[model samples]
Target chain A: MNPSGLDKEIILNAAEEAIRRFGPSKTNITDIAKILKVSHAAIYRHYENKAVLLEAVTERWLSRVSRPLEPIMKENNDPEAKLRCYLKTLCQNKRSSVIEDPEMFENFAILTQNSKEALSTHVEQLFAQLEEIIRKGMETGVFETDDPREMAVTVFTATSRFHYPAFAKEWENPNIESLVNSVIDLILNGVKKRN
Target chain B: MNPSGLDKEIILNAAEEAIRRFGPSKTNITDIAKILKVSHAAIYRHYENKAVLLEAVTERWLSRVSRPLEPIMKENNDPEAKLRCYLKTLCQNKRSSVIEDPEMFENFAILTQNSKEALSTHVEQLFAQLEEIIRKGMETGVFETDDPREMAVTVFTATSRFHYPAFAKEWENPNIESLVNSVIDLILNGVKKRN
Candidate 1:
């Protein structure tokens, strides 16, 4: 997207790949440029600095976390089942990111520790997706709620331990899957309408 | 306790005071010894080193987090009210620890992040207290559950966002009290007996 005639995707891919292979501390703009066969200045045209570029990478990663659940939101399945799948997939996405590349994940955590603007946007996007699912459930007359957005926030915050980075270390417990399931069941039961 | 003419509690109190004043990095056994009017050698005679003393300080602090809830467990209030009081006190304990002394808390978090032996014991203590409340509720026929311990874990994990240090930044939201109440209602509704 910059004047170098290279797609922003290519530059991001190279940056991520370089960071993964070399780790964030050793990876620099020049290394990213080398991987993409473009001038570091070309990368600069898009990102004002390395910090901005890293934030973009973090933003992209955070944006993709809930992608697998998006299909569930649109599916013609029972909203309750859809809710379970949505939460499970959301938790899985976070767990797999930690398992697959812990170094890069830690790098992301450190780089964005003090600045949460990008993270706030990512969380809002997640909230909107969750809100849509709750709204659909309400429309189906299966959920009992006057405020889908508030219900969404309640459910999201409730299940945070299973997905949040702070509790990532607890994810490896043998009871983790069962724990998430129990919480999901409680949420579903709580939200179900009474005749 | 080790010919220092000082009780272990006195030493701990002095150590906590020194850490609060100088911060953790600047705090050392000699500083604590100075505070307690004991020789650095006398302090070493009781604690093997600064690390042991620091861990002990952390352990003592963790032990006290649930103290205020002890009376609620023995109260004759409705089980549901008891549950709410238990959770609220637990949360307030954590929140106050942050608000009253943000520096000390960050120090505690950093010191214990890698070594969770002390924290694991602390979490188990919390789980035990929660299990007691749920068991009483089940006995009163107010709660519906085949396994109180599991239910305890489920509810605790669900509401973790409101209490866990990772989401500490979000606790200041004006809606936090209402949000926590909403989640508590969802949990109570989910686990209440249908009869």
Candidate 2:
């Protein structure tokens, strides 16, 4: 197969599709190559190995979740609203991601557990989005926290039940939305400047 | 061996010791009986099967963690102090439990995952403790939450990273205490009445 017009993006999209279709455990470089109509060597030239390609696929999926939040952080001036939107979007995205293709999600969850580098990078990306909003909040005097980085982590940890994959099993619980809202209230109340 | 005087407590103690020594997968009723120097029938009389015995063992271990928190709820007059102590003790106890016997801890974690009744009962016990403190705080005007049950769940979810066994890998991070304290600060600020 011709290697012309084949790029990282094309390979990654195909890889994601392959994983989504066949699931991660059964996904192989050949499947991606076949999907891309390119030789395995072409994909190898870009990703070096199946693992690297899968990491890119995971990264791509993760970035899709973070990409929209960037504007919320950059464009929105209200820290409280920004924080709320960020958290709600994050929770919604994660829950939908799980709900859409639970089998693939579980496969990737297990895959990410074995790939700590990819896992940490994904976490750091989410943290960076939060830190940016928090830093802005502190700068604008809307929030009272001294360290936005620490506060961001605190928020992430505080809201893990809603967003974390381990707790996805409970997302179907009818009360999850109210639970998420309640926690958000508690967190917002926590970070807001004291009257 | 004679079955007289070999009560549930003795059998549970022996079962725990066997699990701690041989790990849950390998520990069996006969081993527990041998340790108790009683007939296997005696152990069987107390627990119908291995699953039941393991559940009882888990219940015993869980109770040990919760027993100390009971007085903190019932006897402590200051709700804030009680909340702080309950959280700290819970975190410390969970961390120590993991450290003391990681293998057995992992065993129990898996066991609890399979035993929904045991898991929910354990959760209810912890939530009950938090609810008591929150209710007291609300009554005394120290806390400003409308629903104490919701507040307790929020607190539990917020502090999960410190206490959840799945996050044990990150507990050794030197900054865990500071991170925990920062969260506690955020939560306290969240719950306390506005000045």
Candidate 3:
């Protein structure tokens, strides 16, 4: 609850914990309220109902991913280095989340299937950051592509083996990091301006 | 039945046709026999049962794809050009197969899920072809990679949107061909030696 007594974040945190432990299908508002030591009505004031709360939970989780990248996206670092770090950080975060809270992650994958609009927005938000980075590279003469939006999608697809959590089982492979680095090298070469 | 009458190919072709029309779940040996104009016992003599016949059908179908690529694999061409052609052909063949006969492709996908051994062998054969192409590229100092097998998987993952028929709906987009070519271009750049 962050010592604030009760706020949306507190309600969300409690809901997140409950969902993590019990799975989304079984978790209810009363359970979240029990964790918050408050009435379910209090949580309702913030999120409306179970479905809305779950949507909020997804939005919250996805925002954590986007929030950290915003600064990186706006950073003054070399475009290539920034892109490399951006992708590596995204993968590491998703991988650790999958490893530490696999049940929660699995529920999120299933939940997103029912929340396509939120999922699409989340995707667009991530792509916007990627497009920003690619556009910066083009402006600075570091990348050569004319279509930054398409290039961002290309980069996303190319790195799916690393950043996409569905392939988390493959992340346990000892060679995964090196292979990811090799793939990143290849992708970087693909986007870099040829002299 | 071929001119020789009631051979394995004839029975298998009948089975394939039956699967396509009725779908895998409803396909049966009797229907295949009906197509071949032979007694079910004649089909049974070649295949122990319906399951065995289905396995043979999958193997035969996969072989057709591999057979055509053998010469391209052995051809003395620029490694990059060979790879581009190889991947493009694979995608085109898969896309055409899906568009021309979606029912058969869907049945194959479902059937392959149950026939894991045959599916594993089919995957290995495709990976082997990919690895051979990567090895040739490395030998000619065209592509940059220390582990060709891992790189082959990476290539497969990168180009999956086009070659894997599961994404056939996405292939219907008017920009799909150019998008595929763009992705291919990115992948090619990723692999080429950085000298």
The best candidate in terms of lDDT: 2
Model 2, span A116-187: residue lDDT tens:
787788889888888888888788887888888889999998887777677778898988888888888999
Q: How many steric overlaps are in each model, in order?
A: 0, 0, 0
Q: In order of the candidates, what TM-score does chain B achieve? A: 0.88, 0.90, 0.90
Q: What is the interface RMSD of candidate 2, in Å?
A: 1.1
TM-score of 1: 0.90
| Ranking 1 against 2 by DockQ, winner | 1
* Separate DockQ for every predicted complex: 0.73, 0.70, 0.38
- For each candidate in turn, the TM-score is 0.90, 0.90, 0.76
Candidate 1, superposed: residue stretches over 4 Å from native: A1-5, A21-28, A111-115, B1-4, B21-27, B48-51
| lDDT, model 3, position A72 | 79
For residue B71, give model 3's deviation from the true position in Å.
6.1
Instruction: For candidate 2, give the lDDT.
Output: 0.83
Runs off by more than 4 Å, candidate 2: A17-31, A34-38, B17-40, B74-77
**lDDT digits (tens) for residues B1-195 of candidate 3:** 442367887788888889978988799998998888778788888899989989988887777656667788888998899888888777777777777877777787677667878877977887888888889889999998878998887777777667554466666778877777887899888788876
State each model's CA lDDT, in order: 0.81, 0.83, 0.79
Single out the weakest 10-residue window by summed lDDT for candidate 1 chain A.
A106-115
True contacts kept of each: 0.78, 0.76, 0.44
**Where does model 1 sit among the CAPRI classes?**
medium
* DockQ of candidate model 1: 0.73
